[model samples]
Target: MGPVSFKKLLLVFLTGILFMSQSITVKAEAAYLKSKDVTLMNIGTQKVEGKIHLKGDSKQKQIKVLLIKDEEKKWYELPLKEGKFDEEIWLTMGKGKYTAAIMIHEEGRKYSYGPKITVENVGEVNPFLVPVKHVESNDEKIIQLAEKLIEDKTTDREKAKAIYDWVTGNITYDYEKFGKHQEGDYDNTYGALHTLETKKGVCYDYAALTASLGRAVGLQTKVVKGQVSSELYKGYHAWNEIYLADENQWIFLDSTFGVGGKKEYFDKKQSELSHSKQEEL
Candidate 1:
């Protein structure tokens, strides 16, 4: 879109286990591939990996982890920093075999493949709760902040609202990025940490940040890709769907509209919303 989009520690370790308590974490006794630079762990009967540890000493600034899964063979382009990368991943495309490999970005969106591994122990994991290239819910800073915001809140609504209020109140819309988007000058995949650190982003960043925060707090959340019919603007837009356990429902969240002290879009039933949800990006 005339656009944007959005780990850690898990290194916020307690929060992950809190949500995935029923998950079995076994060190599988299978014949696995070994690499001097890559280390994949917690390969048991679980939907999420404890962490995908990689040590790359590449000069390429655009190194990425390429993950492909299932019979659908969907490709998930994950962000990876040079030197050391320790982050959690999920088989969000349902329970199936997955493949992960290193990639060195050549230019544009082209990348060359590097060390590869096939993962086979993932169970049925919720895609919304899983962190991807954009919504990195497993990041430590996001995790710590989510915990801080929802400290005494026992209800999902309260916890989700805490994050909603913080994002809509603190983050300012980046008009400059919008200008560039109209000119089609940049890639629209800036992840959540960029919004958190800079405090400036577009609709995609807003949704990404909300999803990351919601998931970090143990609530299933997703960055919804869709179209908005708003008095202010329209066209391809991004928002959030947060699952509130007590209500047993997923609610719509649009912090972009809620910015500038507005509260109308914070928490509402998904059916009541007029937004057209295309998919979970």
Candidate 2:
């Protein structure tokens, strides 16, 4: 081969190698740019902070993040800019796991990545900030019966069990029965008098009736909205948390489950009770 021809061939080969290397580098950069590394920090006192490091593409203009706390009824969204994002958020710290997702949007396309975190804040009591007043009823017979139950010679546990049993045995689970009346107003199904008279109601009705009766008997009770999940049943459910003076702990008693004649008492630890179900009642 001539020297000139050999030199030309060598130049062509070198040029091809450079082009291939550039192509490989460009592909690697593109893949790296499309994703990000996300770090979530639980900053204590019901606060959360997130750090995102985005490398590669400068075209990624905006990012959206969704944070789902433990038993949160809704997802909270935060907007972010390109390159890197550092944000702090106020969150509810229930005793359980939390999850968050980061979504990148550029040129009308979205990508999401999530990390799950189990937050352990046991032995925390989220006491009701406001005192709930018991609604006064005009029915004297109901009032008398309630007072009598309270005045009856029984231990606190016995009294709580009695009221729990009475509510469960009396009320029947009826979703169709309510038919969209205002909450706590069972005028269609049964008036306060009738509920007290017949001793039957839906979940809310039973809870209300139980609350009323419990209040009459001097027991502090709170009607909480959450789902009940057990070995037998799992779905949106309502139950009550009764404060027992003797035990000094909140006992979870579901009138619905108890009404169904199942003796499943969820005597969970304080940490376990903090995590409500994902659904809101």
Candidate 3:
């Protein structure tokens, strides 16, 4: 009960309060550092674009944004520079419904994951930049081919016809592989590069190569998958639908069935052909 005892007790109490406050602040800061804020800049029919505003300077750390898609159930990561990043971080994901989430990963470990953002098929995705697994539009060989093929072609239609001619003329149909694929003995390597290397492929490869080449030459192109009926049989087929920016119209091309540069399927309408569309990519 003495004055000195009272002073000592008061001093200890003040010190304990200060320590608790410091601990609380540290916890709050840690929580803040473990989370981030994301704002979508733009969402197009075919594109999902956004920016992540990080709380502190994460430049030195290996910060990345993770994009999870429903179709593939894959985690696609885009590295963040200077505490922020844009949609260019992700490779072109074609038109689809995607549940996208932004995550911060640092030092080989995931630090935080934001709420999932549902981005439906927006609109007008840039096909030139978006790439499927095997469809490498930016490949050196594809780029070279695109540049060379269009060197003399003047218009988009002309360029498209030229590409269609080259594919139908050069690449052969892989009936053997198609048979095997039908029997369920398939691998995941079919795309533009495969068709280019082998000079033969099924509908998937043909469509992918066409899209790749088309996109490389500054044309917006997509691979359309669905059913087509022919004299022999009715089955699944893959082809291309290219968007002519100048014409503002989407035209169809069937390079696989157009062997020998047949113009029957080129620029044809859906009602004119026995083709039913299932998906566009």
On TM-score, the candidate that comes out on top is 1
Encode model 3's per-residue lDDT on 1-281: one tens digit a residue.
99999999999999999999999997665443323554333232333443222223334344444555555654443435565554332334555666555555544343566534555544455644465445668678999998899999888898988888888889998889988978887844588987999999988899999999998888888898899787634788788988787788889888877872354568867533778899877
lDDT of 1 at 168: 89
Which residue segments of model 1 deviate by more than 4 Å?
Answer: 1-59, 70-82, 260-263, 269-273
RMSD of each: 17.1, 17.4, 9.2
Q: Can you list the residue pairs that collide in candidate 1? A: 6-134, 6-191, 7-139, 8-139, 46-123
User: Mind giving the per-residue lDDT tens digits that candidate 1 earns over 204-273?
Assistant: 9999899999888789998888876657576788888888989998888888888833656866554235
- TM-score of every candidate: 0.75, 0.41, 0.60
lDDT of candidates 1 onward, in order: 0.72, 0.51, 0.69
The best candidate by lDDT is 1
What is the C-alpha lDDT profile of model 2 across 98-197, one tens digit per residue?
Answer: 4445555435344555332333333333222111222223246656766665566566667777777666666666655644443544435433345666
Candidate 2 deviation (Cα RMSD): 17.4
User: Clash pairs of candidate 2?
Assistant: 171-201
For candidate 2, the per-residue lDDT at 198 reads 61
